[model samples]
Target: MTEILLIIPPFCYGDLSEAGPVYPSMGIVCVAATLEHAGYKVKIIDMFAEGYEESKLKSCLEDPELKIVGVSSVSATFKISLNILKYAKEKRPDTTTIIGGPHITILPDETMKETYIDYGVLGEGDNTAVELADLIIKNKGSPENIKGLCFRKDRTLIKTEKRQFIENLDELPFPAYHLLPMDKYRSYGVYDSGRKTTSMITSRGCPFKCIYCCSSELFGGRWRPMSAEKTIEFIKKLYDEYGIRHIYFQDDEFTVSHERAMKICDWIIDKKIGLTWECLTRVSHVDNELLSKMAKAGCKSILYGIETGYEEGLKQIKKGITLEQAKNAVRLTKKNGMIAKVSFILGFPWESKEEINKTIDFAIKLDADYSFFTILCPFPTTEVYEQIAKEGLFVPEFNMEMYSAMPAADSLIRTKYLTSEEIVQMMGHAYKRLYFRPKYLLKRMLSLRHFSELKRNFKAGLSVLRFTVKSMGKKAKLAKTT
Candidate 1:
């Protein structure tokens, strides 16, 4: 059996974004299970859990007989993956290196331009990865036969035909959670109370066409779901085996099928699985009745992407949810005694100062337990990215390092209506308006019905303050350079 190393790079935000304690890397676990099922010796090194530095990562790659290395990358961690790949190639010149995940899936050809990465996997990677491993084990380097793969041959890039999306999500095995360093992962809500927290995915893909979102493109526009019974069974297993009291559904849209969601909720309730969970949901898919049921079924929170408050800005992004609907959803969630986390984005090209103010005002009025605001980033392979590229709106000199932290004054894109500084200033103002209110603080303080909730909120607030001060300092430094 060949020794294959699957490395998940460190958490790239580095205290910039709220790190949310640490959890097992689901990507590596899924890939490991697929390879192990094929009789391969697989090992996963989750650097985020171990707090491994660059030197440590380099030392780990010193294994002389390692045959293959697979890395997973996201938007914020793409540069980290590149660095890891570069180091791995230098350390083991003969080892086959592969990169996959959202970043590479969206830009396969561009990713293949790097000599360090020998192959890039697109779309769902479990099957593609197993096939690639078998091919590598057989001493075959030809990538043309593999679907959803891009490689180089004789100094030219070659992309194979795209593969169809996986329709039967249930066919996939449960992630190889037992193979991970489980003790390293600690959740604020769990660790502080000596409880346990776990993360799981109930399904994949989103049906929405939000212009700024790439989930629909990455996981096909149609939603593929797991059986409710199977999902509940997994939840029960996590609770029984790992002593997990909290779970996060890490899905793009948890309520894609309301009927399935209700069925799952019923099963969880019927089984008396005493696990609290959170999930991301669309504003349009939620209702008072459904929210009530969810709260009863142990759902503690739901995160909503209310991109903008102005109708025009929402229309430009094709978010498909009205301002009224967003407000109603928040109210319903609160009415049902569950926490509502509202997510907003600022500095869209189509947004003016007036439009951004609308967002701030709406956020202040909605009064969710927590709010998150991010600058609009035009990621590669999205419609928004193409529009920005065509209009020459993107900063041509921007590199992946610039994405590590939140966009500073100098890093924000200049729009026709707002300068980069103006956008950055508006983001600061949005945070102040949404979070620095007496009512907001009071609501947050009073909402902590349990000691676990109180501790989680306190830690999260501290993290936010630390991030804000650091971001402000960085912005000031960037301003001086400019």
Candidate 2:
């Protein structure tokens, strides 16, 4: 019997397919750990990992001992998440429902309007979750005093004082990986090594002010990271117990502190853990020495968010890095024998067709091992979202359901010189220009050192081909309509 059930509502951005990647939510599991450490009976339902079934969810809600149902969500999954919680309230009228995540944190007032949701936990929910559980279990205190909590009182929304971000990350317990379907997610991301793979976040928050990102809103704008010792200990546990061989560091920027990152790498090397890892960071955060250290310590890939190639585009989005910096970072990453994966975003509201195409041209010139060209998705609470709203840039057909970075999908907003169809067409142009080149294909073929690389590359190639075909179909349909 579970006292509290934490759920991740099932969702896929483009379509549900067997080929889609599935992984556990680190946010929910971390909150679960805090609740368990506080002595509450907890269980996790990762409907995303194990496909969503209403019957299965109903059975969990039917538990007599289950008092609270907490659902986690992002903007893409928010609708389904609320539906799951509403179903919970319908099936078990006595149970309380709470919603939390970046989506709810950013738009608490709008989200709390849902009568099915009993409470909302804002940013960094670990401590607030435990407090809510303790309050519910003991049945004494008014939730009025609980920081980082939102509720309705007499039909007026009441959001308590914001909770402070956890300063000492080392004091927090490791995420409840035991409760997750770890094996289901093995070898799951794009940067896998054909070994048992899982994701980890040793830090939170980012200092950069990228307009399309809400990391600051979600993590309180402060970079908080666990000590190197703590990170290694967690890695060791995952290595020994779960036999995880590859880890994807899901930090907003893993190399925020160059020294801490190096120390963690050194510990991994000296301890001979032999675990391959990859991380996503900004182009400005790395240097030659750090790149060399990372490669020597079994780092196989480094993904940089080089969002646009135009110098003026960088300033417009507050990317805080230059084209030269991006080039040097990718160069050094490849120099140190690691895959240099870079990403670019198209469809900025101010960009003309020429400007967008120039960005794609810059991506090919960068000569990274992998290039991810995506249509810009202006998620709520992001500066880009606000700018679009203020400047009347959003397309009349902008739908939250279609808010995704996938190039195959129609863009949510349009630029001054392009429509939604044109943005997607540009995305197809970017993908084809960067991926189908003879030189790029030959380089990838020559770099294959392991069978795992071959398998992963094949899947990636097929996926790109499918998206390109879909984009062409859309283009043809648009031309006929015109």
Candidate 3:
């Protein structure tokens, strides 16, 4: 057995993965398990952990004892990953530099053309990474026929056939949480209302074809999920080992299979592990019965993608859900004693100021426990990106650098009726209007059951206040930076 180091690069707001700074990369952990199963020494360096330094990154790459190094990043952090690859190639020319994650999966050919990136693993990396390590790095054999991989051969880029999706997700090992900084995620305020928090993805892909979403682009529309048995076993391990009381299910569409979700809830109740959880799913996939069962199973919160208010906008974006469905889902979640949090986006290419206002009004009327608003980021490999590129509306300077969905003054694409400045202001206004609603404040204050709950609420309010001020200030300067 030889050494290999897996890296998660830091990006906007110091986040390294989509689960935020608090959660380790399930993808990276899966790959690590594959290597470890093959009797390889592996170490994972998630840079979001507090005590990480830049010097350590260079040293990790420079270590000759390491046989191969894999790095993963999303669309927003592709440049950061590329820079790290360049440094790795410069320091240890012999070490293999493999890039994975959402970025290269969507644009493998272009990404592999970069001289520094030795290989790009598309989609799920567990099987592909293991195959690559066994053949290319460990055995020193041929790289051809290694499915779901892209690399340059004899100065020409080559991508193998796509690998089949993992059919039996239960066969995969539990995420290598021991290789991660468990205490660091807890200290970072990652959970909703639990003492210790972690995340789990029971499924591999999304079934929907939402145009603005990258789920289909990266993982495809095949929704392969672990069985209810696996789901229970996973959470039980996290609870007994890491003291994870609140597990956020980061599945793209958790309730897509209604029966499976109900069974999962039943299993949770059967186990009585005292582990409260939260989940994100589409609005239409849930109903009153499911919501009631979820609450009974200790679900504390639910999130829906209420992307727009009007049916026309929904049609344009292919959200596949009517505004009524969204409203009912939120109402049911609240009625069932679960926190109903929803998210909305601003600066759609076809959205005008009036349409945007309608969306904001709808969110306030729904009165969910929490709401998130962000400027539209037309990321790569999406219908929104395709439309903007076809119209030549994307600003040349911003490109991939501005793919972050944070409220920033600069937009990567120009909308029909709003400038970059107006979009940013509208984002801030959305936050202010939603958070400052008298109804919202009264509901939240009443919902606080304990003195410490009130104190946490106050601190959260202060945090939002500071963010609002900073977002407004950014609206006035840096017209082209994130």
lDDT tens per residue, model 1, 311-420: 88888999998999998999999889787888898878777777888888888878887777778887776788778777766566665456544343244365667666
Question: Quick one: ranking by lDDT, best first?
Answer: 2, 3, 1
TM-score of 1: 0.91
Predictions in order: lDDT:
0.77, 0.84, 0.77
Q: Is candidate 1 or candidate 3 better by TM-score?
A: 1
Per residue, candidate 2 scores C-alpha lDDT tens digits across 324-355 of 99999999999998989888899888987788
Off by over 4 Å in 3: 14-21, 58-64, 186-194, 404-409, 449-463, 470-482
Per residue, candidate 3 scores C-alpha lDDT tens digits across 1-482 of 23788888765542112223366677898889888887778888887554446697776666667878788978666777787778877888888889998878877766776888888898889988888888765685567778888888899988888887788899998778888877666322322444677678999898888888888767767799999878888888888888888777888889989898999899888888776888899999998899999999989888899888788889989999999999899999989988888988888998777888888888888888888776787767888988988877776676444543433434676688766666766666677778977878897787776665666667667766655665566544423211
* Candidate No. with top lDDT: 2
What ordering of candidates by TM-score runs from best to worst? 2, 1, 3
Reference-based TM-score of each model? 0.91, 0.93, 0.90
Clashes of each: 0, 0, 0
Query: What is the alpha-carbon lDDT of model 3 when measured against the actual structure?
Result: 0.77
